[model samples]
Target: MHSEEDAASACAHATALIAAGRLAEAREVAETALETDGPEPTLLLVVARAHMAEDEDDHDDDAERVFRRALDLFPDHVDLLAGYAELCLRSDALDRPGRHARGPVLLERLRELAPDSPQLLRATASTSVLATAVAKGPSAALVQSLDLLQALTTAASPEAAEKDARRRAALAPYDRRLAVLDATLTALARPGRAPLRLLVRRRPEYLFLAQLTVAVLLLARHVLGPFPLWVTCAVVVLLQLPLLALRLLLRGARARGGARASGASAAGPAPAEPPLPAVRPYTRRQLVLIGAGAALAFSAFVTTTVLTHLEDIAYPRYEAAAPYTFRGMTRTDTGDELDTTAASDPSGRVAAAFTYFYTGGSGDGSELAVTASTGDFHDATAAMVYESDTLLSSTPGVGSLDDSWRADAGAYGGWMQCSRYVEYITGEHKAICFWADKGSMGSVSFKASDMSHADVEGLARTTRQTVLLPASSDS
Candidate 1:
């Protein structure tokens, strides 16, 4: 109250309280400000409104006194004049027959000052002239209708007057609904309302879209590749679930403001609308369901992590298989590499693999490998040709020969991915065949001099027979 800033804050708080239907509290705040802050128009209006909201009868209401005081400061204030005029009309309706009543005179004044004033326009309807416009009410536009509502204070017969006053009182409240609507509209123009409207209506949708977009991107997996992107996305979804839960916890903290809030009008029933459904927290059932989903999501993440770690550690699990043999050639140098470091580059990760270097009588040689791991053999082969860092540095490739390639893994057997490449000035063929059956997985890769597509297929089949079959069947 000491400063304009303080007064404005008080006014905002009081208005909010009023909007919340805390009229008694609103009145207390407004009244305190009026007494201490000297006379500010907005504060006066609040005080008057708070008083009008509480007063039940047309009898001498305290709202009138506050209105008069506010008007003394800003006499032409559109809201003040309209509010005061409405109160006067209601007051005069009861045959309080002292003057045609101040309502008519005030209306005539407002008619000039703010002719289209929502309050003034509304008050015009309540004139006994328009009272007949309300069905089953007063019969005629009395109060000296000839002079145009101004002669409401003119003397009339006691019997006729008493009858008309009774009619006015009954018809007053419902008569000026249009004005109430207009006044309510005018009140809606205020600060911070647009943002609240967005929060209550549009922001939730945006949050859902953002969450969906993130989920889609994560699912695509081009970014943040440490974990299975799908699982990571699930985890992210869970993180955002609380807000997203609203529908879509928005299933997150949902801004579910469904019904609109309103209080009764002071001047002829302030416009009212049925409330929107209220914003609510998740119910017990909803919470339980969310908790169940969260538990599952967390469990999946843990399970995926454990499996991935197991894969990285899968190295020493695969029994070292014997190298294959060919006519007039021997697996002269054979060795294997097993990478057991978890979270290292999984793409190039050879959990366990055996490589055979074969030497023929004419110094012709080839390399063959059988690998078992969680990493994809397809990427391994592709990355080898492209020399991408995703593959192991030692991964072998006949440089720039990736163009000649064909693949055919008929459902029953892993056979047939062959490529013809030139190496050491000799045309040769390479074959990579991969297989996955439930928990069993591995791939066969062969590279040799002068090997044709048939040779590639034959070697792939022989490699499978050499590595995957029982030792006795290798014969």
Candidate 2:
């Protein structure tokens, strides 16, 4: 039988790897211990950890199974239970859209078992708030959760009461963690206090370089003002790669410097190692170029951002389409009228007309549109196609719509006009007149007090009939 020291050392090594975020290495270390020593409760725990590291999809039913096996060996294991519950929460098999879900039930069980446990309480409360938020968007759920958290934070527990005594007696080290968390929360809650500013201050070089690259993209956007912000962001990301490399190089240099310092301190005045190689300094010309590039990048970023904001503020775009006559052109270049008088109403109505479109006549008909809609222009169209087809296809790729979908969804403008465009395209050709009301949808004649999911669905159905697929086209 192995000595206690050997087992403890193995455990320590595995734990160190885990703390260093070398999870794969930790798993290997753990597995080695288990394989060499034999089956044990701690070995099972380590094996479960290895499974967790391997499971990228977060579908760690295997890990859960291992944890359960560990629990069987050593019952009432809090860590194992916690891990299992977390797994359940991540997988949609447990916590779902419905009111009664496995996640909620599991959480309730956890609460019963560890009511006063601060960690358990925090996790339960946070998850509860998250679920509520998912069901009802952020504004409503965030406020409720914040209130609950604040109230709970104020209460003194048995642990808190004996903090000083516990600290002196060395009975509790983890209690101090609560104080740190509390302070962090307090700082986070402070008004007009931007944490991002603090982040920039701490890592000014990284932020500066990143933002400078972003600015260069914005300058490009300013030069070619029609490009979408998302596209600009993509460009910025691509441009920033070189800077990211530079940052990594600099970080490596710092790490080497730190290592050198640590070695010097540890050795305690080692015979001066043959005078260290002289470090190269930046040339004046190189420094000037770097400074100029930085200045230009920053200037571009500031100018582009300011201009974009200014443009948005000054010449505010409207959602609803302006009243215009739509005539099929008889002549290509001129406004000569043809047979079709396809005029769009001020509402800009459309309908969901399911049809298929050929991609290319020359190519092998591999990519043919199965489900296409006229009015269903937004993300819903693609979502519908994917949802309908996922069951049939083994390997799903290239979602419902093309790149044009985003542009069609009004990528160029703000939400206001986009909202109207949606109404026009989606709303059943039912006359939807826009007004200056803070909250309302559709007809001015019928005043809308509030909107429900059913109301939206009803509107969708109506839009399908009236605008999207007019009876004439269907018949």
Candidate 3:
């Protein structure tokens, strides 16, 4: 004989207990409410939440069972669907192949119940972004997420929008997801007349367009020999400037027309004037169509490029020459020949060598190897060389000719010199030099029983100037 107020009070008490971290107490209260007043949606939610609050391995399983039973009783409840969807999203069930995750299903149901609701739209959009990420990739998910956020911000109440902005701002510094969201929001909120405002607002479309343009530029470069990346980028920006200006002009015209219409309506209409000739200017739909066409063209160009240059792109050509002389040692054709390997992909090229050797005056053998790669490898090579040098310096009984002797290979070069003379570990004395220019790197190891530290240094310099320079220049 419990009243409705008693049921409400019991549900509230259970919610408070769960929030206070008293899962057992919350479960007890919810169970008591269910027994007293039958299975109500609120009581069921409380019971489900209480089970979820437990930190056991099987807590999610128990929570799912409870939620399923509650949903059976109250199928279309927003609170129940939101809770279930949230649970599914947080669980690994979504990652299972060939299985439909409950999160999307529940979110879709919630969307049906409240299509225009800000909270429902946000949840649905977020879930869609996650689902898209799993199925497609981050880029596709990013585009969808940006569109959803733009719509959500435009439709939400001021308070809700402010809260969204605050949440994004707080997470932007630490989380990439929120950082992207913050950037999109910032672009959307830009002043109407600001430079690139129109382009930024339609970022996803423009980004796609930019991608297509870059792909075409890459294809053109491949066919026309070579072009600088900065030059290509500049051309793309210049091409888009006219379109941006047109959009700005259209926006201004629309604003002015609206103002004139307001003034005319306020003053009352006099006589109808003859209509001007119909002029169909470029619309947003038209612009989108143009972008789609460009994307399709880019796809064809990329496919052609891949098919035509498959061998050259997949397996780049690598060339290296053995040093003629090193530290008064003449060329020995009997020694190790240059063993070269080259690899390439859409990113860039990498060339490696292993068996390039030299013989000193005393018949002592030495080896020189080089690895050259395209793109930014400066910092990585520097850090790796520094670490190796530190370890070599710390090794006992290892001495160097001049600790201050640094190789100058130009602006984009990193060099390290170490001695191979070990008093305690094998009496074999040698000199090791590692140098990098831009993305190209080389290592020279000199082993000669009578070779002085100065002689090794001279050999290292000669190796850099002759053997490694050619490979680095091509990089």
> Candidate 2, which segments miss by more than 4 Å at Cα?
1-9, 36-39, 50-55, 58-62, 72-75, 90-102, 111-241, 247-475
lDDT for each residue of candidate 2 in 1-475, tens digit (9 for 90 to 100):
6766666667666664443234555567777777777656665676576566544444266676776677677665555555555545555543433322455665666677776776465445435546634433333122322322332334363234234322322321112222222333333334553432233123335445556666666777667666778976786677566546434433443344323332221111122221211222334664565576678776886787798776544421113221121111111222222111213333332322122222222221111222212321232223332232332232223222211111121222211110111122323211112111111122111111243324423332332223222224333
User: Where does candidate 3 clash, by residue pair?
Assistant: none
What's the distance in Å from true for residue 119, model 1?
Answer: 40
For every model shown, the clashing-pair count is 33, 12, 0
Q: What is the lDDT of residue 374 in candidate 3?
A: 33
lDDT of 3 at 453: 57
Per-residue lDDT for 1-475 in model 1, tens only? 3999878878887776665445676777877877788888888888777765554543236777777778888988877877777667755455555323888888888988987767777767655545524412221122112111111223253234334433442333222222222222222223433332232233334444444455444434433345555575576666465433322311111111101112223332222431212223434664555455555545555655665555444321233454546645566553324434223555554334444455553522245556544333322223233332223223355444543344443332422344444443434555455444322245565565555666665665565455543224233
Lowest lDDT sum, 10 consecutive residues, model 2, at 413-422
Q: Which stretches of model 1 miss by more than 4 angstroms?
A: 1-264, 267-297, 308-320, 323-328, 331-382, 385-403, 406-418, 422-455, 464-475
Alpha-carbon lDDT, every model: 0.48, 0.39, 0.55
Ten consecutive residues with minimal summed lDDT in candidate 3?
A: 268-277
Q: Rate residue 37 of model 3 by lDDT.
A: 89
True-vs-predicted CA distance for residue 252, candidate 3, Å: 2.0
The total number of steric clashes, by the backbone 3 Å criterion, in model 2 comes to 12
Give candidates' CA RMSD values in order.
21.7, 24.3, 17.1
TM-score of each: 0.33, 0.31, 0.33
Residue range 1-475, candidate 3, lDDT tens digits: 7899989988877775554344666788889988988988888888887776563438767888888999998998888877777666556553532123767877888888977766465455545546634432334233424433353437454345435754643532222233333434444343563434445345446656666766677677667866676787697788677557644543443344323332221122111321211222335774676678577657856675675566233321224555577656665564433333333233334444444455455544354433333333334445555456664565445665334344444433456544555434566565565665445565666565576656666666666556543434455
